[model samples]
Target: MIAWIRFAVSAVLIVTGLVSFAAGVIGNCRFGYVMNRVHAGGIGDTQGLFFIVLGLAFGEGSFMDILKLALLIVFMWNTSPVSSHFLSQVEYYTNPNLYEHMERK
Candidate 1:
């Protein structure tokens, strides 16, 4: 039925969204720390972790709930990097070699 199809589509979106969101969070956590090992500042420290937690928490329960969760996760996943970039720019400007070892150029 149409309802079942809708439900299936929503579920797929939610799962894929969560998976992508999780991967970004974990990646940023791991490498972000390594990039700033001595310091205690990175995307993982700010909205990144918060978004992931919120997404997971919000994703629970019914299909509608998961849809909202998926949307939040997608939004966070898209914006986290941009936020991180700004944060990094702030940190890098203050210390030009903040990530010297990892810097490509």
Candidate 2:
């Protein structure tokens, strides 16, 4: 019973992670511009990765593996936003008519 419960929980988490990934893919495909695409990609990088790592951790029995996964998730959570910001800055500077897509505040 315990093993079955673990299996069920892990399966649910993995499925949730997959769904998050799917959402990100759809968002990336649907968005029109670089900044919008970066936002969509960031969703997958952080939330999708978090769920996937959390699911993997649930399946693993070893403490060290779980700790490593936890660290990976933390690292991703920290970096995804910074990378997105950098990409946005790059887009802002490089795009010749940035004002057409976004209004300057």
Candidate 3:
């Protein structure tokens, strides 16, 4: 059923978010580095947002509520990337050691 599908999707999103958070924490603690932190953060946002929207879909919500939830999901998806890009730019600029790994002439 559709409800089952929504529940499954929500579960998957929540698991993905948890895994990403764990990876971020482990990477920071083990290496004292923030490699892929932005990616992990974005994954957290995306998975968390989708999980919420899917939960709403499974709830006793009206058509308008579902529409609003969809809009929120779309907005989150759009803004998450922009925010990640800005964060990455800041990190890249502030951390010269990161760029030292880059191949250069």
Candidate 4:
């Protein structure tokens, strides 16, 4: 029973992570603005990665595996936001037409 519950939880987490990633991809495709796309991607990247890592760790994971996943999550959490910020900064500084292409049409 406990094993089945664990499996269900892990499955749900993994599926949710995949859906989040797909949503991000859709957001990127639908938006014309670079910053918007970056924002969506960053959010999805972090959330999906965290969810997937947690799912993996929850499924028959030893302490060391969970520890490693924790570290991985921390590393990715730190880097993803900073990279997104940098990308947004570059777009802000380099793109003179940054605000021009934001129409929803």
- The lDDT leader among the candidates is 4
lDDT against the true structure, per candidate, is 0.55, 0.86, 0.69, 0.88
What's the lDDT for candidate 1?
Answer: 0.55
Give the RMSD in angstroms, all C-alphas superposed, for model 2.
2.8
Model 2 pairs in collision: none
Report model 1's TM-score to 2 decimal places: 0.48
Model 2 TM-score, all chains together: 0.85
TM-score for each prediction?
0.48, 0.85, 0.61, 0.88
- List candidate 3 stretches off by more than 4 Å: 1-31, 100-105
Residue 11 CA error for candidate 2 (Å)?
Answer: 1.0
- Preferred candidate (lDDT higher): 2 or 3: 2
Angstrom error of the Cα, residue 87, model 2: value is 0.6
Per-residue lDDT over 34-65 for candidate 3, one digit per residue giving the tens place of the 0 to 100 score: 54666666765777567656665666357888
The model with the greatest TM-score is 4
Q: Order the candidates by TM-score, highest first.
A: 4, 2, 3, 1
- Candidate 2 lDDT tens digits, 31-81: 888888998888888888887887787788689999999889888888889
Show pairs that collide, candidate 3.
Answer: none
> Which residue runs of candidate 4 sit more than 4 Å off their true CA positions?
102-105
Tell me the tens digit of each residue's lDDT in model 1 across 19-103: 6556556665666434453133333433444545454544354677667766766776677566667766676678656666665
**Between candidates 1 and 2, which one is better according to lDDT?**
2
Which stretches of candidate 1 lie above 4 Å from their native place? 33-82, 103-105
